[model samples]
Target: MTIRVVLTDDQPLVRAALQMVITDTADIEVVGEAEDGAEAVRLTAELAPDVVVMDLRMPGMDGIEATGLITAGTGATRVVVLTTFDDDDYVYGALHAGASGFLVKDMALDDILAAIRIVAAGDALIAPAVTRRLIKEFTRPVVSPPRWSELDGITAREREVLTLVGRGLSNTEIAGELSISIATAKTYLTRLLAKLNARDRVQLVILAYEAGLVATSQ
Candidate 1:
């Protein structure tokens, strides 16, 4: 299956460069390109790509707000935030806002492509330390919110899967831990991701942390 993609960044050269790299992959296709956040949203709605490569510093909408809007409105489209700044503040805000993946611009093209493929396959995320740095910088000391009764509909096993996900455990690891098959673990993750209003495992991880589902795990 072709993984349709959208590239959103203010700089034309940057967008072109990313396009060249992404288009090199046989399974990935650039469906659309946007110059700013609003255009990103607009193009996203129109093209309904499988993934979005977004820049945080764009004018008009910014990646954080764009990620929130995109995830909330079109849960089918996964977002991968790209930026020059791996600064904790930007990374945390983008993930909290609902990005499916986070990549530093300094990362090699291969690394960025791997991120896109990981999220496109279903649900994937960056390293634990990457997520933790952002979390510590952005997560307020405020008390965690109570789990809504809606979440109670999820099974205890699902909760465990969620915890593992938030802890940055891959489906293979979750399967190994639970003594189950990878397919079963991924199925559980898919159901939990759908139920939690999450775009992917990455967003679920953020939610798990935000709602105190997993502590000292990120």
Candidate 2:
């Protein structure tokens, strides 16, 4: 199946460039384009693309607000924030606003495509630098442990997977940490998503941080 994508940017040149790069791939399609955030949201609601490549500095709605609304309202439409600035401040905002990943605009075409594919697969794309900063930026007052109450339906192993995932481990890494197979790790991840009612791993990561599963310790 082709990966349907929507590109949202104030610049026609940049959006066109992205479209050109993505179209080179056989499995990706530029389903539509949006000039600003409001239009991005409207088109997203209508088209329901698999992925949205969002620019941070749009004129009207801006990437941050658009990301929040898009992720909150859409089903299965993952957003990857793109920008020339890696100022670090924007990182938290984008993720908190519901971006699945952040990519510096200068990234290679292949990396950009990979980021989209990663988000579409329901895995987060935050590198260690971003994850560390995001954790520090967001985890101010530590919250309570993840409750067995809300987590009633989750299995013990799934709980284990969530905790490690919350710790920022990838699937391969998580499997090695738990002495399980990669397939088993993915299964646990799937189960965690279902039980926690999380749309994707990004939300799961947020939940873990909120529930005190991981934090920047003293």
Candidate 3:
């Protein structure tokens, strides 16, 4: 199956570079390109790509707001926020705005492609280093009110899964750590998602951090 992609960056060079890399992949296709947030939203509505590679610093709508609109309105198109090291505050907004995942701009092209594929497959990816940094910067003395009801009705084992997830472990890694099958790990995640009313794994991670289920000490 071809994974349709839309590239959005204010810089033409960046958009062109990403388009070149994505178009080279066997299973990915660049269906549209947008140089700003509003254009991204419009193109996403028109093309309905499987994934959108979005730049966070664009003018007008900006990627954070764009991500919110795209995810909220379309429901099917996933947004991958592209950011630099100084964009931690924006990263926090992006997370709450329904981004599927985030990527540092300087990451290898192969990793970026893999992230898109992972998110398109309905999983979230946050590099461990990036996750730690964001948590360190965003963690407040008081977390916002619980997204759901303070983890009520959740089992101890499920809390373990959520911790690993908040720490940015993939399902395969979580299964290995717990000596369980991958399917079982996925089942736990699905249950957590439903119980917490999360839109996806990214939201689960946010909840885990906000609820102090995961620490930012690392």
Candidate 4:
């Protein structure tokens, strides 16, 4: 199935660069382009694209708010945040706002494309270096209380899957670590998402951190 995508970036060059690369791919198509967050939300509602590549800073709405709106308003569309900044606040905000993937602009165009595909395929992804930073940053004290109670409905095995996900392990990796089939690992992940009311794996990762399932020192 072709993965429909909408590019939302303030810079014409950034949007054009991504569209140029996407045009060469067979399974992914750029369905629309938006210069700001409000336009992105509108395009997402109209196109119902599989994924939206969002930039953080824009004239109005902003990517974080746009992401929240898109995810809340539509079940079929997902957002992947692609921005120049890898700041901790941006990462936390984007994931909290329901982005399925978080990528920095400096990453290779090929990798970014791969990320879009991953998100489109119903999985979530974060840049490796960013994942590491995110894990460490979660150890810091936050202004609001951590929602540890969210994990109450999940089983221990589900908690294990969530922990590995928080550590940025893929389903295959989680399977190997627990000596289970990849399919079983995926099942646990799906259960975690449902039981915890998570939007995606990114939200599960945050839940793991908030519940103190992930080791900060690791």
- Tell me, by lDDT, which candidate is best: 3
lDDT string for model 1 (16-100, tens) is: 9888987778988999999888999998899899999999987788899888889888358989888664355666778778887
Of the pair 2 and 3, which is ahead by lDDT? 3
Better-scoring candidate (TM-score), 2 or 4? 4
Best-to-worst ranking by lDDT = 3, 4, 2, 1
**Model 2 vs. true fold: TM:** 0.80
Candidate 3 C-alpha error for residue 85, in Å: 1.6
Error (Å) of candidate 2 at residue 200 is 1.2
The lDDT per prediction is 0.79, 0.79, 0.85, 0.83
The true-versus-predicted C-alpha distance at residue 151 of model 1, in Å, is: 3.3
Model 2, residue 103: distance off in Å is 2.6
Model 4: weakest 10-residue lDDT segment is 137-146
Q: Give one digit per residue, the lDDT tens place, for model 2 in 148-171.
A: 476678777777787787777788
Candidate 3 root-mean-square deviation in Å: 2.3
Give one digit per residue, the lDDT tens place, for model 4 in 17-116: 9999999999999999999999999999888999999998888788999999999993689899976554666667888888887767888989998899
lDDT for residue 43 in candidate 4, whole number 0-100:
94
Residue 89: error of model 2 in Å?
4.2
After superposing candidate 2 on the true structure, give the runs of residues whose Cα lies further than 4 Å from its correct spot.
Answer: 84-89, 121-123, 126-149, 152-156
Clashes of 2: 0
Query: Residue 90 lDDT in model 2?
Result: 60
